[model samples]
Target: MQIKDFMIDQSLKELTEHRTVVLPIACYETTINENIHGYIPLHWHDELQFVLVRKGEASFQINEDKITVREGEGLFINSGCLHMAKDKNNNSGCVYICLNVSPSFVLSQELYTTFVNPYIQATNISYLHLVSKEFWANNILDSIMKVNQLIIENQPYFEIDISIHLTLIWKNLIMNGVQLEHEQKEMLKNKRMKQMLNWLHTHYAEKILLDDIARAGGLSRSECCRYFKRILKKTPLNYLTDYRIQKSLLLLQQPESNVTDVAYQVGFNSTSYFIDKFRKSMNMTPLVYKKYKNSHSPFVNNST
Candidate 1:
């Protein structure tokens, strides 16, 4: 549940620069089990991202759509899309390679205007699942894997090689054509949802009410409930409680922290209520979970 070194502004825009000014691309091999929560929390950035499942299947929530990418398959997420990923099968956590490339890294102005800008700004195309059944999609998957490998190995001229692969992937996307009618309502819902989630993340440690959340999103209580149900499949208060519990996990692992103190710090008015919710969500009491995390080598891979 902890995003290592991950920072987001009040707008819920991720502050991490996955791609640099000089390189404009970066890749990483991520394992779902390594993340304490077995999922990457919802966040977005300006980079167009490609995720290729290397070992297991991953279920992704992009905006309000759920897409599952299996082994050897991939997914393309457009820039500025709200997305998160988790293991589809919890028994074996998903292992995937991610490539984040700047949308503006085009070869020329012509390419940028013709292929990149429109695709990145396409409100209807939040994400596209890539399966091996489609030949072009398979190629894109191969390119994504190759780019990850090239970056990992740091081979000579790997930057050039990676760029070539990315260009090919971009061409495949444009030539194949992904088109859908825009849904302005859904887009606005996504914006309002982000606003509310941002407020929750910022104020989870403070006492909150349903009306407060609604006001933060500039919506009525009913509309706020509907939005949360539509996007997160949970009530506003439920999501807030879940978030508080997630925040408490890291605190619970701290050496000086105790269950009662941690409970109050995370905005739980009653320690018993916190313990009950913790037990239900984690299958253990907060004290037991704390002791276990303390006894074992802590889960240090924080980049959820």
Candidate 2:
């Protein structure tokens, strides 16, 4: 979902919403997929997010891949990637630790130009799963643990320790050749995809077609669908429908809005059709979703 409304931006991200300027890093512990929804809603961020499953099983949607990471495992989401995290079954609470790191805080100019810059300039690797026994994965996880420890202890020069750990993590990834996809063609594709997503997000509440979206991205109709299919594993219309449902969630927050009105405002023509799609996506009716959100009130779920 890429509404980018009041809470999150158009790319469905909360960029610096939870990040600090001085340290440019944050450690978050959260339990998600409990008491309410089955999954964390799809959203992205402007920083690389490292998720470690402390208890229970977790699933992550990184671009086209559906990664199921069990306990003790971790995954690294590239910056500005469209991803979602949630409990696998929604029966048990998925507890996890998330470390958000901004590369600028730790990477030197040389490292950035050679490693981090190339990684950021292109868009092939959506996420790299840190598995046990794997060479680079093991090294990355070790660095993640060190960073977690330093942040939690906050001893003298703890920030410096965290920075060192962060550097180690990137170094491990770069050494494993994760930055080799930074070619000219991928850079152009990434830029065009972002532009297409922006156009779709801005016009989601209006009557728009695939051809219009293709034109906005400067691509042919078939190529436009192919681009989204390759990266997101979904059709253009499917993404648009999901995004409309996401926008409707925010609309349902208003006490005065009814289901039909909310559906119409979010660009759905038929009320019953909207209800069906919303129920299928969110596992509840629009009215019920509104009530649930109100009950949760001021505290935003930090599972993602």
Candidate 3:
């Protein structure tokens, strides 16, 4: 999939490439390259995902940890975990097949209660890295590849075959999954982070303060800064600044939009300050980027 843009909601939930409601499942071959920002930005979705890397390698940042999936390896991401994938070197790209399926599509009441819910609901296990070395993990990877094949082939009763394979994959997980202790504090922090992110996305166009962001997440000022740094690896204000610049990208692409108006529209108090930050982040002036983008120039700025 050559993703140009992602449709994300205020709460950081992904709303794009989600197929029909009836089946609630789809597969696509995704390439991480310069066209789509050279990375998949942080976003969460309600569907469980499996990524099988076919070539090169991709580094994934899931919440607080980072993992690298190489060729012939795969990964399983639990539903609603904040994650992003990119080529760390940024020279060669990574090619992978992704299968996203809603949990409700495969899990019945009994299945949820008995096998699937425990792992998916566990706060400590946001993702499982699958390697060909482990027998169980290899099985899961094979199943993911099989599902991808079924989707591509689209033979009669392919949906049923896909469902059966997915169910068995869950069964393999339940049977061989390692036990993990629950981290209640981590769960609470994740919830708070989501709350803060929602507030930021909802009101990025307006002037914001650190205290206001702390209040939205129900954290003290100091605690808010600490958590933001711990999880996101950036200060709250830094994140806000970057987000403002990201939003300004679309506005600057407009033919009639000027830099000054775009700056103030995205919460920058001064045009000079916005231009400085934009140049720092993008390595080019806003007007220059606008020109290159509008002309469909091959110049690629892979800065995220």
Candidate 4:
């Protein structure tokens, strides 16, 4: 569950250089298990992701919200939004297809006039979380399934056909509940939030207090709390806890580090405390995480 590094310049270059004549959208369907848990721990990419739950249920953590998507439902995670998905069901695991497309692939003048402009104008929500129980969600899911089939089938103009269906899905999403004023205000607030988050990412392993983040954002503690709640829907400390756990994940990946060392490195004082937090946040103990990592790959024994 290592978070993928986001090289902004490289990503933008990739997006811009990618030819539109035949957009190369990566598609994949994978299974989840104890070894290959199918947990994509919190990460962000520049590409928009469309995931359809063909079987089993998935709990998706998008920013601060935890959403459960069951079979017959699908999710559209917009670009730059932190998200992760995992199966919480015990009996049967989940299977899903993921389609990732660079925004530039569909950001043509025509698409702009039709969907992009409207989306930009309507909702400041960086990621669109679609809850599909109704026919609308089903229709979009059906189209996405077909797109995957076509891509796998390697039929002619498959990319174009997928794009067309994707556009329709976008239109339906906009029509459902997206609004302009709310979108604008939310976007402005999110900009400030991102600045705050960047600062935390650079300094989380160090001693950082709520006041420090508040001052960095040019807001008082109370104001910062309200602003954070508005955008991220979580308190500062909660966000910090999740962030710390995420950082610890990388440390856990290393064979040289023990659970206690990982805890102290991530700023937790007590090993017991770290274990408690890691269990609560990740639903697995630190040792289990290490074992999971080792089971999936070649183990290099590094004892401290």
Choose 1 or 3, whichever is better by TM-score.
Answer: 3
Worst 10 residues of 2 by lDDT: 1-10
For model 1, which pairs clash? none
lDDT of each: 0.82, 0.76, 0.84, 0.67
Task: Look at candidate 3 and tell me the lDDT of residue 243.
Answer: 86
Which residue pairs in candidate 2 collide? 4-9, 4-10
Prediction-by-prediction clash tally: 0, 2, 0, 3
User: How far in Å is the alpha carbon of 236 misplaced in model 2?
Assistant: 1.4
TM-score of the candidate numbered 1? 0.90
lDDT of 1 by residue, 1-304 (tens): 1123355665568787676335887687788766776477677988898888888888899887898888989999998888878888875668888888888774556679866777777787888888878888888998987887777677778888888998999887776666755677766777788889888888998999999999988999999998888778889999889888988988998989999999999999999999999999888999999888887744544355
Rate residue 6 of model 3 by lDDT.
Answer: 77
Off by over 4 Å in 3: 20-22, 297-304
TM-scores of the candidates are 0.90, 0.83, 0.91, 0.72
Candidate 4 C-alpha lDDT tens digits along 1-304: 1122322221111222212346746666745443233365445666677788778988877655678877877787776666767785854667777777666665566666766654533344555555566656666677778877877687777777877876776667666665645455556655566667767767777778899888767779998898768656778878777777877876888868899988888877789988998899779999999988876655545555
Tell me the TM-score of model 3: 0.91
lDDT of 2 by residue, 1-304 (tens): 0111224566566634445335878776767754233456566677888877878988888766788998888898888777777788776567777788776765987667766766755667778888867888788777777777776676888877777788888878767675355667866776687778888888899998999889988999999999989877788889899889978876898767899999999999999999999999987889889987777766655365
Q: Which 10 successive residues of model 4 have the least lDDT summed? A: 6-15
| Total backbone collisions, model 4 | 3
The list of candidate 2 runs beyond 4 A from truth reads 1-6, 34-38, 122-124, 177-179, 295-304
For 1-304, candidate 3 gives per-residue lDDT tens digits of 3455677898889987666334688777878875335577788998898889998899998887899899999898988899988875676668888888888776777767666666777887799998989888889899989988887787888878888998887877666658965688877888999999999999998989999999999999999999888878899999999888988888987878899999999999999999899899888998898887777635555456
Candidate ranking under lDDT, highest first, comes to 3, 1, 2, 4
What's model 1's overall lDDT? 0.82
Model 4, residue 295: C-alpha shift (Å):
5.0
